[model samples]
Target: MIELRNVGLKYGDKEILKNVSLTVRDNTIKAILGPSGVGKSTILKLMLGLIKPNKGQVIVDGTDITNMKEASLYSIRRKMGMVFQGNALFDSLTISQNLGFFLRENMKLPEEEIERRVEEQIQFAGLEGYEDQLPESLSGGMRRRVAIGRALIFKPHMILFDEPTAGLDPVSSKKILSLISSLRHNNNLGAVIVTHIIDDVFNVADCVAVLYQGEIIFDDVTEKLHNAQHPFIRSILSDKILEL
Candidate 1:
């Protein structure tokens, strides 16, 4: 489990996260929802150790990693897998090569074993015929799938998703949501999904947390978000984020 205890981060006079506390249980999906610029993405950075909190502890499992040394942090981050906006696939590498790239660089696995895992990952993403295809050759949704496959190739303990459906049409977005749901159900992976789309919350999330001015104003099950007492959350649900 990942737990943030009264965490706070600031840049000069602006606090990016304020007394933020939440728990993401193991084998569950936690969705962070808020308007743009509310520092939703910053939470992912803090958890990944890309950034540090000014106050409070970031505890994962039984260890407090808030102030771990950089060298040690790399080992911790190795357990994390991130799927960013736009997929971030390598331009030149084919799907299998992309999935195998990190394994070859970091693990020193034998060629045949890498080949086997690569094959499994490609199939895991439901990309059977696109093993040799480069990112440019695949559709947007397919590229996202390949990115997910690459992230999961290491069998990561936790996954981070930043706007996994951004810039895609409705159909493509739905497919990505389904893929995430499938991953959570099948692999029991812990996921932190940062998104503004409430549909994503209702569709894929086990719990929803709303960021308001760098603070979590609402953190509860998705079914409770629409009825929260917070004005900010009420306004968001009432307007359907069209006002965002």
Candidate 2:
């Protein structure tokens, strides 16, 4: 499980998150929903120990990582995989190389094992024949799938997604959402998806935490979101997509 206890952050004189608290259990999908520039992605950085909060604690699994050293945090961070908004694939490398790159760089596993893992991710991501192609040749949705496969190659306990469906056609968005849902049911993996799209939340998240003005205004099961009385929540419910 991951828990943020009254977390707060600041950039120079500007505050980003304030008294924000949330918990994500295993084998479930949780979404951090908010408008653009509201520091939604900052929360993922905190969970990974990439940044420290000015106040409060970030607990991952059972360890309190708020003040942990970078070296110590390495082991902790490996427990979760992160898929950035941009697919972040190496444009020069083939799809298979991209999937196996991290294992080759970070682990001392044998060549055979690396190949096995890479093949597994290719099949999982449904990219069997495209393994030899560069990311640039694939469509936006295919690139996103490759990114997700790369993340899952680590076999992390949980996955963190930053705007998983941000720039895709409606069919592509639906496919990505289906892929995320399958992670929990088929792989027994938990996920934290940070998105502004309301339909994306309803499609995949089991629970959600609504962030606004650096504070979490609502946190509960996805169904309860419709019952939230906050004006921002009401406005978002009506808008469906938070372009703000």
Candidate 3:
């Protein structure tokens, strides 16, 4: 589990977030919904210990990692995996190579174990035959699946998705949502999904948090978001503001 308590952050004189609080609990999918430039990605960074909150605490599992040393963050980070928006795959590397990249680079596991883990994730992602294919050869959704498989190589208890279904057709988008739902239900992995699409939230999220002007205007279960009374949240639900 991860929780942010009254967290605040700034870049120069611009305030990115102020007194924002949220939580991602075990066996649940929490979607952070907001428009572009609303600091959605920033929250993910804080959770990963890539950035520190200027004023509050970021608790991961049971540890407050807000002020943890960079060296000490490795252990905490290994428990979580992040699927970047761009997929961020090495185009030159095959699917298997991409999934095993970090294991070979950071982990001292034996070659056989690494191969076993890579194959395991390949099957998990439903990309068995594509293991030898390069990123350029796969479709957009396939690439995203590869990105997710790579993240799962270490079997992290929690996964963070940054716009998981951002640029894809409707069918592709739904497939990604189904995959996320399966990952949560079958694998029992907690997730925090950052997205602007309302459909994405409804499709896979168990809970929702609306971020606007650096503050969360609404936070509750997904079903409640449809009946939200807040002006901004109502606008979002009505599609008056599509992005948030």
Give one digit per residue, the lDDT tens place, for model 1 in 1-244: 7889999999999878999998988888999999888888889888888888999999877688999988888777778888877788889998888999989988878999999999988777779998888899988888888888888888888898988887778998898899889887898898999998878888999998999888898898888877798887777778775245
Error of 3 at 16 (Å): 0.6
Q: Give the per-residue lDDT digits (tens) of candidate 2, residues 59-94.
A: 999899999999999989889999989989999999
Per-residue lDDT tens digits of candidate 3, residues 1-244? 9999999999999999999999999989999999988999999999999998889999999999999999999989999989999999998899999999999988999999999999988887789799898999999999999999988888899999999988888788888899999998889999999999888999899999999999999999999998888887777778833653
How does residue 80 of candidate 3 score in lDDT?
94
Q: Which is the better candidate, 2 or 3, if ranked by TM-score?
A: 2
C-alpha lDDT of residue 179 in model 3: 90
Ranking according to TM-score, highest score first: 2, 3, 1
What are the lDDT figures for the candidates, one per model? Answer: 0.86, 0.95, 0.92
Worst 10 residues of 1 by lDDT: 235-244
18 Cα displacement, candidate 2 (Å):
0.4
Kindly give the stretch of ten consecutive residues in candidate 3 with the minimal lDDT sum.
235-244
Ranking by lDDT: 2, 3, 1
Please give the distance, in angstroms, between residue 134's alpha carbon in candidate 1 and its true position after superposition.
2.8
How many clashes does the backbone of model 1 have?
A: 0
